[model samples]
Target: MALVTTTEMFKKAYDGGYAIGAFNVNNMEIVQGITEACKEENSPVILQVSKGARSYASHTYLMKLVEAAVMDCPDIPIALHLDHGPDFETCKSCIDGGFTSVMIDASSRPFEENIEITKQVVDYAHKYGVVVEAELGTLAGIEDDVVVSAEDSSYTRPEEVEEFVRRTGCDSLAIAIGTSHGAFKFKPGTKPQLRFDVLRECEKKLPGFPIVLHGASSVPQEYVHMINTYGGAMKDAIGVPEDQLREAARSAVCKINIDSDLRLAMTGSVRKHLVECPADFDPRQYLKPARANIKELVRHKIVNVLGCSGKAL
Candidate 1:
């Protein structure tokens, strides 16, 4: 029950023909909810810590929480990952601080600069036996403090992926394939589509290499309704369709990022419980159900979206 790097997970996922769910972890309850679901499903999971996560929950607390998860679920294959590490210093710090996997997100910088930064991170991370994941194209949407509007988002050119992989020597590539960031990714009257053609082209160029999809959460309408019906106002909040995510997983895309759905699930339950039971003032009375809802949501993602149930040791 030790933490592992994404390299091993991606290799196994690439061979198994199913992607592992890389869920974002912000706090103790979120970590417990996700890892507990993983134990139930017998699926390997990645507990990704973003910059905001580190800031919100102190790095020491988050690390200790994951360590507690390892102790709690001794059989699950869990990896502590740094999601979207902005620069070499951040990536290096996470690697030094016990993160097994770190993503060098320089997609916002110039292409050559991005490569240079990613290369630097790779050199540093490899020294610590930490795996590095890099992004090729920019993803549009707001994730915590990072914000990229729709006009700025660009698809990853298939021609550049091969070169990016060669030049940077990143372990995995997180590519933008029409899946934007945030819950309200697509507008009310539009259907969200992942560019399978681009994925096919990348697979053609770099066979057997693991690919990653960001902002792939399918915002379940049931949760949305619960949130709205129970005093929350997330109207028309939609996400990438499950079929689209399933298609990616069946292909070379092996890591799917999901956060908003879990947030929605937890908030929906908490709001409902708060609205229906105004007399219940205890924090646990509300938080317990919220945690349970998040667990159910994670289990559903493993069984339905990722199809990774029973794969863990």
Candidate 2:
């Protein structure tokens, strides 16, 4: 099957009380691992490319890799999306380059300006049969090119959602409800909580619209311990509690972005593999286990967190 937009998937998720996993893809292993798990679990997924991913692995390479995944995992639906697209140009390029969906992240701009820029991209994307996802409030922490200070971050105002959607015509809306980018989402001794009150208010306003949660990865403690035990220094790398994320998934959240956890899984596995077999220098020797870890992580997410397993064709 061809790549699909998130429209139908989000509709199903909203009605069925589940969310689709929007995993960020950087290389062959990541793409293969994610898609393989989704294929096995019978869950639809979004393989998203960020600006950094496009730079690390060229856009052409990523597209072909996704194409390969599509051919290999033909039973399940897959969507190639541009994550955190900075401007209309990037969104347009993705749409023209065959991505099924694009996100125009203008949340860093002023409210009026964000609406204007998002509307422009939405207009162009809809013309090409591509769906657009736009962000409302800014999220803190680092993710690729996206960075915001904690002082600058703000939760999405529920009141503004209706007007923003009415004006932009975006297929989905990403709202900041305290989920931040990167592994260090919260401090070491603090509780990690999402403002479900804000979320519910937005849902009440935007009723059936698909809501998205960025930086929702639950940084597994096992991966963090593995990385540290294998000679790495990562401190205070806490993420949104899995229980909170599961609650969000059961609500209006249709797409949950998970990048840092995947990075942690791969990094921890590779570090442990190398530590165990110091004499081995082959890339596959380490990458094989890393890939397996990513696959297992994705499967766990599909079944336990997102609740989308067995929902795909």
Candidate 3:
């Protein structure tokens, strides 16, 4: 099948008490690993590209890689999404370039301005049969080009959701409820808790609407340890607890964004492989294990955290 929009996937996830995994993709290996895992688990996926990713690997290259994935994995539905689009031009470019979905992240702007910008993109995207995702609150930490300090980050106001959605006409809303970008989601010795009350209030306001969670990567400690063991020093690299993410999935959250975990898994695997086999100088020798680890990490997420495994079938 060809690429699809997130409308149907979000609807089913909302009804079935699960969330689709929206994994960030930058290169061919990452694309292949994520899609292979989703194909094996029989789960739908969203392959997201960020502005920084587009800069690093040109837009055409990323689009072609996604197209390849679609041809390779024909059984399951896949959506090509632009993650954290900073402006209307970027969103429009993605919509015009054949992205199935695009996110206009204007949360940092004033509420009125955010609505105006998001509405502009939504209007243009709908004409081309593409869906738009909008962000309501700011998230802390760094992810590609998105960066907000902890003090600057705020939880999504449940009261503003109704009017925001009504005015913007966005297909999905991303809310911040303690999940932050990057691996260091929380400080050491502190328990990370998602504000379910805030989430429930938003759900009450927009009962059937699809909700999204950005910066939702659960940075596995095993990968951190692997990286440290192989000449890396990343201290206190923590993430949202898997149990909390699982709870969020059972709620109105239809799409959970995960990038840090994929990075950690791949980086750690490559580090270990190169450390153990110093004689091997081939790129494939190192990247093959990294790709395998990414596949396993995504498979674990599909079955345990997102609970969307076998749903595609």
Candidate 4:
């Protein structure tokens, strides 16, 4: 009915063996497409905003758009969250500005510093009945403000997870097992496989705790082909496989972040549309199909990947 925290949703998902899709939103069409699909699927969803998104569309406009989505879909639960919040000020801003959840990502910092900052955010967010998500290990690839090289990316140490959760009191933890950010997640010859051994070890360390996977987009080849077919140049842009993501969902992973896939779907579809309809000049004429494609992609994720369809109240 209204914006809510991920607490209850994560609890249910942890028990139900499904993950909630946390899709990044930067504009009206992106919000509309994601919510409409979640509405149709009867699934709980998270609409996350990055600092870049807030800067691009302005926080006021994005909040208003999410409010419109809440009005449009009154039956489903939607959590408005800040994705990859870089600092305490940003986290505080989001918490004060009506975000239901905010992630404090200090993974780039040292372990003690990460705990200190995350604890600060957790204390503030809990005071306002908002949830906090924190990151432990660093992820590779570029996405908005988050960028780490392959040499710097590290898998989350299972041994430290229990202590981190205990000290930080974060609602969930985003661990970098193997998933990287951006469209070009992996190199050409490398096999894409998550360190489930690492994941399971983390689970063992923190039983029943909600886990999050960032850079989880699949980078569907269908959309890639469409993009390349229509004069786009994205080479070797592979992502985490969908089946592996589904497997993760059936484990301790309760939230999966998706961004690049939506971008690809929208971009590829609109490119095809413009190429086919060279005479069309209206924004709606092109964005209509793009929005529709996003909706379908999200719906497919709900039904086939995340397995959260019909889980919303």
Q: lDDT by residue for model 4 over 1-313, one digit each (tens)? A: 7899999999999999999999999998999999999999999999999999999999999999999999999998999999999999999999999999999999999999999999999999999999999999999999998889999999999999999999999999999999999999988998899999999999999999999999999999999999999999998989999999999999999999999999999999999999999999999999999999999999999999999999996
The whole-model C-alpha lDDT of candidate 4 against the native structure comes to 0.96
Model 1 TM-score, 2 decimals: 0.98
Task: Evaluate residue 156 in candidate 2 and report its C-alpha lDDT on the 0 to 100 scale.
Answer: 97
lDDT of each candidate versus the true structure:
0.90, 0.95, 0.96, 0.96
Q: Against the hidden true structure, what lDDT does model 2 obtain?
A: 0.95
For 143-261, candidate 1 gives per-residue lDDT tens digits of: 88669998998999899889899999899999998987788889999978889999999999899999999988888999899989987788878899998898789889889999888
Off by over 4 Å in 1: none
What CA root-mean-square deviation does each model show from the true structure?
0.9, 0.6, 0.6, 0.6
- In candidate 4, which residue ranges exceed 4 Å CA deviation? none
Q: lDDT by residue for model 2 over 230-312, one digit each (tens)? A: 99998779999988989999999999999999999999999999999999999999998899999999999999999999999
TM-score of each candidate structure, all chains considered together: 0.98, 0.99, 0.99, 0.99
* Alpha-carbon shift of residue 144 in model 4 (angstroms): 0.5
- CA lDDT, candidate 4, residue 163: 96
Q: How far is 43's C-alpha from truth in model 4 (Å)?
A: 0.5
Model 1 gets an lDDT of 0.90
